[model samples]
Target: MNARNAIDMTAPVQAPRDAAPASTWHSQMPDDKAMLRAAAELTRDIAVARPGIYWPDMLASAFVGYAALAGAILVSHPVAAVLLGLLSALALYRALLFIHELTHIHKDALPGFRMGWNLLVGIPMLIPSFMYEGVHTQHHARTRYGTVEDPEYLPLALMKPWSLPVFALTAILLPVALLVRSAVLVPLGAVIPPLRTLVWERASALAINPQYRRRRPEGDFARMVFWQEVGCSVWAIAVLAASFAWGWCPLLIALCVVSLTAFLNQVRTLVAHLWENDGEAMTVTAQYLDSVNVPPPARFSGLWAPVGLRYHALHHLLPSLPYHSLSEAHRRISQHLGEASTYRKASYPGLAPLLMRLARSTMTAR
Candidate 1:
């Protein structure tokens, strides 16, 4: 169905007071049926892999992250330690963000990128690439995008004021939660069939919505899950054992780095969507409109929402486009579609403004 006829655009939204007054562009923009077709024709060539950019960006970010992590652990000065920890978190967060690309980028094109990521960052972080690959695709599925079946979605704007803080606070516990899930739950889940079922449905994926459950994976996907989980289980135990044998300093550094990254990721999640769908099945255009995109001129968006996530709405419109191409695609779209396009509605000023808007919305909802 075309966007104009199928999508709901009346959901309440408020721009941060400092933002340009909330635009009425959605009323003027072309429907998704046209937007999608245009995006496909315009980005077809750019969507192809440009490994020169991909390899260097991913590897360099991983290196900086690890080196900074080492500095955080070894440096004795408190100021140096904090700076190093923050650097580690940002770099590692960028590197780990590649997991999203893994879900969309074809394996044949990327070759060993997936295995390298899982070994270097994924298992060590207690979030195997398979965890995201298995579940994130469902978020892109048309029938499931904003429904209870979509693990990545939650209707935060419609919820009570108290629910918002609870959502943010969950990230504080992520490091411990991931460790327990991998080190303790994974092994038990293997031995106990019922527990295994529960783990498959819940703990196996990195998800936001509490009601979303994963279906059991099979064949190659199942194998990928098994090996990745096994790696995470081993890494978690080894880290724990090392802390006891060596010093708590190592454990502290790991916790601080992972927790900080996870916390930042949680905040990113908060602004990724307006969360106004309220369990309804939204049209592709409605979903894209409901999503947020923090465009250029927003300081540090390139760093904070790294891996092309700053263009989240555009990504929803064309899921197969690689991260490196999103900016170009957005540029092309904005230039061709003009200022009044619904695309403008998806764009936000920055993170602080978005969060303030969300907080205000939640209080009003309550």
Candidate 2:
């Protein structure tokens, strides 16, 4: 039997603060290199993807999302429009989750997937995958994972409760912000070299923390960023022109899709980690605990955390492992290491309890 199927997989009990200090959570855990080597050996056979399994699901998700959005716009009934909008949001959010995969999966390994996602989802959404490439790698780096340098890892536990609303509200306004960045900022940066350098370092990154500035891209990578930004600029202008010609309803519908997608992604990011690190460089074990894994038997987790992100701690352990292979990696690690392992401790019960825990912490801190 698969290790994941062996037992009822509820959230593992969190270790007490004294027993598991913030700085030393991984002290008793297995060596990172050895653990990964063992996991790699166990999952070697299952890591590779069958194109048949990969392509169809991705294409289907993209198609369904766009079709649902169209249904929202064309459907005359008010009830049908709201339902279609909700469905479109969920579907597009799932498709957008593929952006996380693009950060880990090499272009050569899944050539079709890379191009397909960019054309079908990225360009249309105005969030091209290239923006994430260099930035996401920093989040996976050993020393960088919980640090200020890690753009994706915000220490939400340290922030005031009021700031949480601001964090979430930013997502709702992301549609307008991204449009302005692409349509206006990108073009201005193109003509002015100094401004282009500043924009490349500051604005081009898709980062969670405002303080995490990006380095300038060079040569081939710079060219990739240039083209992707240009594509988004053109798309933004076209969207504006279409809205002007066809009227406000179409623009309103587009905003609904983008806004909902961004909001859902923000919520996922909130639950992705404990947000416990306080600018400290966490140990491998500490980092895993600081992160989260919403394990199986919780079926609804898949809807909120599509693309294997529910196994986020596992992804941290094996950043090179593809999304489709994360469950197997978790199983192998669980089977080899057993129930009380640090790996098991990272698993959470559900989103509500997790969010409640974070809220309680925020209150206590205040």
Candidate 3:
């Protein structure tokens, strides 16, 4: 079946019903066929991934990030170092998010882009493409989304208020955690069979769900994982060795930069979804509503939610649409569907309101 046919978009668009109870909010909504069809038809021309855009953006972001990181480490002035470190974190965060595109782009769409990204941003960051490749796809699956099976989801809005802060704060330690995973656990896993299994199943993927356990990799994917693990291990050990041999200043600065990047990502992830569903599978329209879109006028969203992630709700509707094309795709669909359409319901004004909405939900959550 074609992409349009894949979604059950036969039902006509209707006024959104009165708010259901928090637990059943997403489960009861039906698909919006008019919005779905408009999205598919209006975006056909721009759907193809463009290598020209992809290569330059990735390369420039990587180059600027590494350069800023070097300046942060080498410059003696504390003020200059702080500015440079911030720049490095933002640039690298954008560069690293290309992994999201890698998962959706066809293998042939941009040959060698995956390897290029893994070398430039992935291994050095200790978050190789393999970590996200097979894992993130599960989040987009029809039946598994928002379920216990989904690696990328958790019902945060329904949890205690403290859970939200803890969820975001934990990401600040990711760089150190990654260092230990690669430098300590991975090397030990090479010799210990059980440790290898445990690490692979529990620590391999970039997942938010604590209960999700990854299966063993096989075929080409297994080979890819082996090589990526090797690269990360070697890089992690080298960084540690260099830190000890020289002063710890350089490594500490780099870790701080990565920590900021991770923290920003965690906050973005927090706002990406409404997190209202209580372990129930949602229809396409329901999923879109539960997700979010910080479109135009959300000035800072592009910095935090780079690489088309600002259109995350729309992304659920068209997972395979190239990142570079998301803005145009969003525009075409919004214009075609108009203000009263289901498509408009997903778009938010900015980040502050979304965060406030999530915080309010947590206060009343059962």
lDDT of each: 0.81, 0.77, 0.88
lDDT of 2 by residue, 225-332 (tens): 777888889998898888899898977987988798888888878888888776777677667767778878766888888888889888887777878888878877
Index of the highest-TM-score prediction: 3
Pick the lDDT winner.
Answer: 3
Q: Itemize residue pairs with steric clashes in candidate 2.
A: none
Q: Which ten residues in a row have the lowest lDDT in candidate 1?
A: 1-10
Model 1 CA deviation exceeding 4 Å by range: 1-30
RMSD list, candidates in order: 5.7, 4.1, 5.3
Per-residue CA lDDT of model 1 for 152-269, tens digit only, reads 9887876887877788878978899899999898899888999999987887788988887788889998888889989999998998898899888878887889889988888888
lDDT by residue for model 3 over 121-233, one digit each (tens)?
99999999999999999999999888899999998878999998999999999999999999999999999999999999999999999999999999999999999999999
Compute each candidate's TM-score over C-alphas: 0.91, 0.91, 0.95
Candidate 2: segments with Cα more than 4 A from true spot? 1-16, 19-37
All candidates in order of lDDT, best leading: 3, 1, 2
